[model samples]
Target: MTDVPSSDIAFTPRVKALQAQRGSRSAYARMEERGGFRTAVTPELAAFLAEVDTAFLATANAKGQPYAQHRGGPAGFIRVVDEHTLGFADFSGNRQYVTTGNLQENERAFLFLIDYAHRRRVKLWGRARVVQDPDLVARLMPEGYEARPEQAILFTVEAWDINCPQHIPRKVDAAAAAAALARLEAERDRLAEENAALRARLGER
Candidate 1:
């Protein structure tokens, strides 16, 4: 994009050095100039996040013991609060509270979101906070999900990166399969009605 390295929203010292050594620094720098990676989310990014039903959250305690946890819900469980903020309701589960504990010890976290059917993924670096506000919990709730909300986990995004679909295997969403079935049934019904109408006209003839 630009002639020189423009920004490093998610790049650390180790990352930049490695990219330089591998001769990819310039390419990455150009990408940055094009806003391929950014510290703030865009409206398009918000909509993408809202439609995903699952994400993996990575966190670490103050001791640096890392933990990876899966968060899921009906589609649209995650809400984009602002360009820089997104969050979801913490549902009642095993009560292990590993994530909650780690967030208390260290707010730093990362979210990995994937869309298997589209073979797309996005990673976000952020700080998470546990919220107890009732209004917020209610606001983030999905329309017909039965999960009990414990607390709201709010992520304040620092930087985000999107990945190419190179190695991601294409898969299908269950809902997509169901939608296909419905379409097939509707087509079949329309054909059957047309056939019946033709038969009646031929009988009259």
Candidate 2:
């Protein structure tokens, strides 16, 4: 959680204006017609999506200020439905809902998927819509799992691109995944204990 100064990291007006002008054209020719940028997703992109368990989602506000949030789930959280479509399960968070709020104002978003275990990364760009259809959510959920009614957001991906792995280092560990899960459970238990103590002290007042 490092705070990035709004001034230092802000997008230039030219870039912001270009994004606004691009709007929502899908085809490269149509995007070119509107002076928008375009990129193609490759097989490498699909492989990275399958391996990565977390991603950083970036969006902007009405004033063109950008925000980035790290989102995580079990491996395969982001599913590639096809060459152009991607799906993911969005769960409850700190409740600020900044990403959702930004999407409402501007559907444009960028997703960064990094597979640290393999030191690989990919970038996905698209428009997202929050969906609440039970059937759709159910279909997206892994086998033997049910969607939590209150904590799901469906992202309809429009375009994506894969980056070259030249900068990424190679590394892998079989135990790393299990160790991470155990650490999370331990932290949750510690937090619950502290919360109970705080509640007990309040009752004594």
Best by TM-score: 1
TM-score per prediction, in order, is 0.87, 0.58
lDDT of 2: 0.66
Model 1 lDDT on a 0 to 1 scale: 0.87
lDDT of 1 at 40: 79
Please give, for residues 1-205, the per-residue lDDT of candidate 1 as tens digits: 4343224546767998999999998887667678655777798788788679899999999999999999999877889888898989999999999999999999999999998888989989889999999999999878789989999999999878788999999888888899999999999999999999999999999
The Cα error of candidate 1 at residue 35, in Å, is 7.4
Q: Pick the candidate with the highest lDDT.
A: 1
TM-score computed on alpha carbons, candidate 2: 0.58
Question: Which residue runs of candidate 1 sit more than 4 Å off their true CA positions?
Answer: 1-9, 32-36
Tell me the alpha-carbon RMSD of every candidate.
2.9, 16.1
Deviation in Å, model 1, residue 178 alpha carbon: 1.1
Q: Which pairs clash in model 2? A: none
**Cα lDDT for residue 84, candidate 2:** 61
